[model samples]
Target: MPFIPHTDDDIAAMLQTIGAPSIEALFDEIPAALRSGERDEIPPALSEQAITRLMRLRAQGDEQPSCFIGAGAYDHYIPAAVWQIATRGEYYSAYTPYQAEASQGTLQVLYEFQSMMTALTALDASNTSLYDGATALAEALLMAVRANRRCKSKRVLIPRALHPFYRRTVRTIVEPQGLELIEVDFDAASGQTPVERCAALAGDQGLAAVVINQPNFFGVLEAVDALTDWAHEQGALAVAVVNPLALALLTPPGEWGAAGADIACGEAQPFGMPLSSGGPYAGFLCSKQALVRQMPGRIVGRTLDADGKPGFTLTLQAREQHIRRSKATSNICTNQGLMVTAATIHLALLGTEGLEQVARTCHANTARLCDQLCALPGVERAFSGAVFHEQALRLPQAPNTVLERLASEADLLGGCALGEHYPELDDMLLVCATEQRTEEEMQRYATALATILNAA
Candidate 1:
């Protein structure tokens, strides 16, 4: 039997109290056409068993060919233990820990996450987490502006090779705040932003920060040290949007120079987090201790209990909205807790050596793929700079046509075409290679691409 909450008299009485003759009268303000004028000509709801069978059939029909795409989101391996622990009722349903005194477990996990990120970035401290890499970068730019005392030097230099979405996000956040964004061009041959060229733009006194990506959008490593030095010499902060996986093999941004990096931000999607379409991913923000007060999100810290046992609690939250109104450093209240938890577990499971192995595999796979593609008759390297896992290849044929043909005729997912974002590279395709891809799969891609280009 259907359980009804309101009887006819009860609804009528409630409607009368609001001076409405009937329930339908409450919606009179809505236009007649906009209302549910025509009922959905549909079938009745099905039983649970029938619904399950129908859903399974739909899922099967929607399955696609194997994927080889990874622009920002990747297809990496996640250990069973990660889901096993993350699915615990307590962890899955946990909410923000308002009262630290009774939330030791949640606080401790967050504290460990912060510590892990700090150690990885080789920075003094890190926040709990943020929405994703793009927003973290946006917040970092804002922090640089505030740290510089909101000087007239509100100009931010973003390298042209940074991810297109991230660049747009930074502009969206800062343009309304009266901040100026200047995009510096990268050498097409080197795929690295020319530091000297950028230095020329650093006039006397209006450059707040310079933002560059490590292993930039084209997958080529930038001359970060030179760029960081030039920015600091001009009294501007250096912000890097990094890939956490590459940090395992390359030098951390904090070690670039004395004034080093004022802030480091990046996507943590490669860290055992599933590419659930594009997100529900975590972003990490780390900076020197001097700028902690202006840092964006909540940070978890370790402490001692009343019994002198090791405990945890939310620390340095005075900069948040609840504590300071308009003066708050950031209005970001909650974080990606479950995602952060997954990252924490994945990092713990991998440890130091295991992470290095993962990085090595990704690098090796990418090198192999690059070599094969370069050897093809119509394919060549877009840039000569050293890369980690992804690379851009210049093709003789239109990349979009080739990609469509590859998907439809060959039943294979292809790389992202650069023409969609940068018209200058109409025939360039950006491809990624992860540890999950087998050698057989790489060979298949190579043969299919070669055949398609030859036909074109």
Candidate 2:
């Protein structure tokens, strides 16, 4: 039997109560042309084997091109075990733990994820997860505004060096709430947000926070220590936007300066999440325990139950859904649970040393590829600074022209063109070479780029 919740009498009673003559009257507002009249014309369902074959045929149309673009989403090798375990029925179908105590297994995985994030960021605490890196930064900005008791002003110093998408997302989320985001310029030569530029804002009385992106959008490492200290000197919180994998090699935000960054957040896509065409990626947000209450999303905590057995439960139900809407710390309704599960398993499979190795390999490959590409005529470094796994190269010809030719002729998904966002750097192309890129692949890319440039 089809599990229909309402009987004929129940439907009739509901329609009568609502002053509708029949159930179809509810959708009378919808135009007849727009609606499918009936299910009679629907095709018969295919058998299991036939469906599988059809899906395979459809899948063949999708091309897995060698990816080099890493604006925010990354391409990293996921150990087969990461997804195999994450996609298991137990972990895959789990949702937000609203009941708290009942969903022990789901809550435990989230707890582990929080623990891992704190460890990686070297922060006092971490929330379960957020929508993605961009929104996480937006949340961090809002959290800073709420938590900074000393700075009453909603003015935040945001660097142009931060990812362009993150900056736009932050503006969309916080501007309506009366938060003012002040744009700070990066040193053109270094692609680093100079402390001197931020220092000018010292005279401004109510600076809420300063946003710092380590190995920022251009992949050039920022002077985080100087920037963090500068924000503190101005009576503002320092919000660090970071790449999770880079934390393994670079100085974690928790140790940025004499006092350290107050909050750290970024995308966890590099961990175990695949770049499924820029979708469903996980974001992580960590903060000093002082700002924990102001943080958004679900926070899973572990403790012992009455029987003295260990247990996991949701702590700090700060969203509007759980608390009085007016008193809620954040309007965010839920966290990215499945992505967090995959990240937890990914981190567990690759311990501290293993994660560090991956970071080192990514850096090494990027540096090598940068060197090879720069050797070609008209191809030069866009910024003269040390980078992590991504670098911007100044192409002789138009970036789109080169990218289109590379894709059509070489079957290569070329790097992102900086022209769209940074008009001044229109000739530049930002590329990344993760640990997944091999020596041969890098050489191929270099050769293809050279040919395209030479032809142009």
Candidate 3:
């Protein structure tokens, strides 16, 4: 059925009943001086076929190639059922569960998402969301400062190996609050955060927190356990910025050290979301029990009403966006409901074994590709440290130029060039291969990269 409410005759009858001359007359209470005339800028409405053709032409220009880029947004295979069910009227149409009773479905879905995230992070509690991974890290950093009442200064220790965009975002969000982000340089040989360097920076800084990535931006696994301990020894809270998919195969933040990470946050996009250009990706923030109240975003709780039936409802309803201005835990506007819904379904379908398989497959594929590609001339791994699914490789030519050639000439995305962000890594390209990538795809990438490098 058409969504348009009433026919012209019905609208006329209703207008007559309402004692209004016409629809425009009903709004005559406003001044005529404020009214703007019809717009000539808007083109005449095109037929459905014309609109479809136009859109198709535009889409053809941006069709996805054989993707190898994974700076932050990853290309993953989402099951068809994930969206078909998520887009259903019951799940898709619902908004935030402001009223506990009316928004039970939304509340339950959020609750499930939180539970799954907590399990993935091994943290005591998980907030429904933040804006995205970068902002999520910022919020987690803020929570760390608030949670550590004993800490006097609002200084956060960040590793240079963390995602460049994430670092920029954290600075944008937290710098104005008098929080100093001390970026500790990574080890030249390993591409991992140098624990000693960070330890020295945290020394006597009265640091509120230390942020670390599991697999740093170069995809080299950091010495998380030692680093977590070092941060605690310096009397700073450890906040982990991680990749959710990597956690399935690696140690989770909460299990990092003897004390565990006080907070954890990361992009949940790889769970099922596609790299639709960059995003609409969900950011997950999880923290220990002591830091729950200081965490951002909404939390849903399972409860039973007086009737004795089980139910779900919104909890910690005291966020600043909702009401309490100065006392709010976070100023985030809204949650990524659609993305979370899809992620929740993806997780449910891919249980522990399935998730592990996917992670292992990605690692195996990446290792295979790296070994094969490194055998070729002028291609070598940038770091000697153990890596995950993604790795940075020093290219023979300018990374951006080569990547462009690969994309335009060979129909391959190849990888993200690191030189722009980290000028020291002049010819490095960070490449990622997930479970979605076939062996043929990996070989093709290697062959093309070798051919490009070996050319005159």
Best by TM-score: 3
lDDT for each residue of candidate 1 in 175-245, tens digit (9 for 90 to 100): 88778889988888888899877987777666998896898998899988888888887778889789988
Model 2, residue 360: distance off in Å is 1.1
Please identify model 2 stretches exceeding 4 Å from their true place: 1-58, 318-320
TM-score of candidate 3 versus the correct structure, residues matched by position: 0.96
What TM-score would every model get versus the actual structure?
0.89, 0.90, 0.96
Q: Write the per-residue lDDT of candidate 2 for residues 350-392, one digit (tens) a residue.
A: 9999999999988888889989999999889999878888999
**Where is model 1 more than 4 Å wrong at Cα?**
1-64
Order the candidates by TM-score, highest first — what do you get? 3, 2, 1
lDDT of each: 0.85, 0.88, 0.87
Per residue, candidate 3 scores C-alpha lDDT tens digits across 143-212 of 8888888899998899999999999998998988888999999998989888889867865757889888
| Deviating ranges (above 4 Å) for candidate 3 | 1-3, 47-49
Model 1, residue 16: C-alpha shift (Å): 22
RMSD of model 3 against the true structure? 1.8
Which is the leading candidate under lDDT? Answer: 2
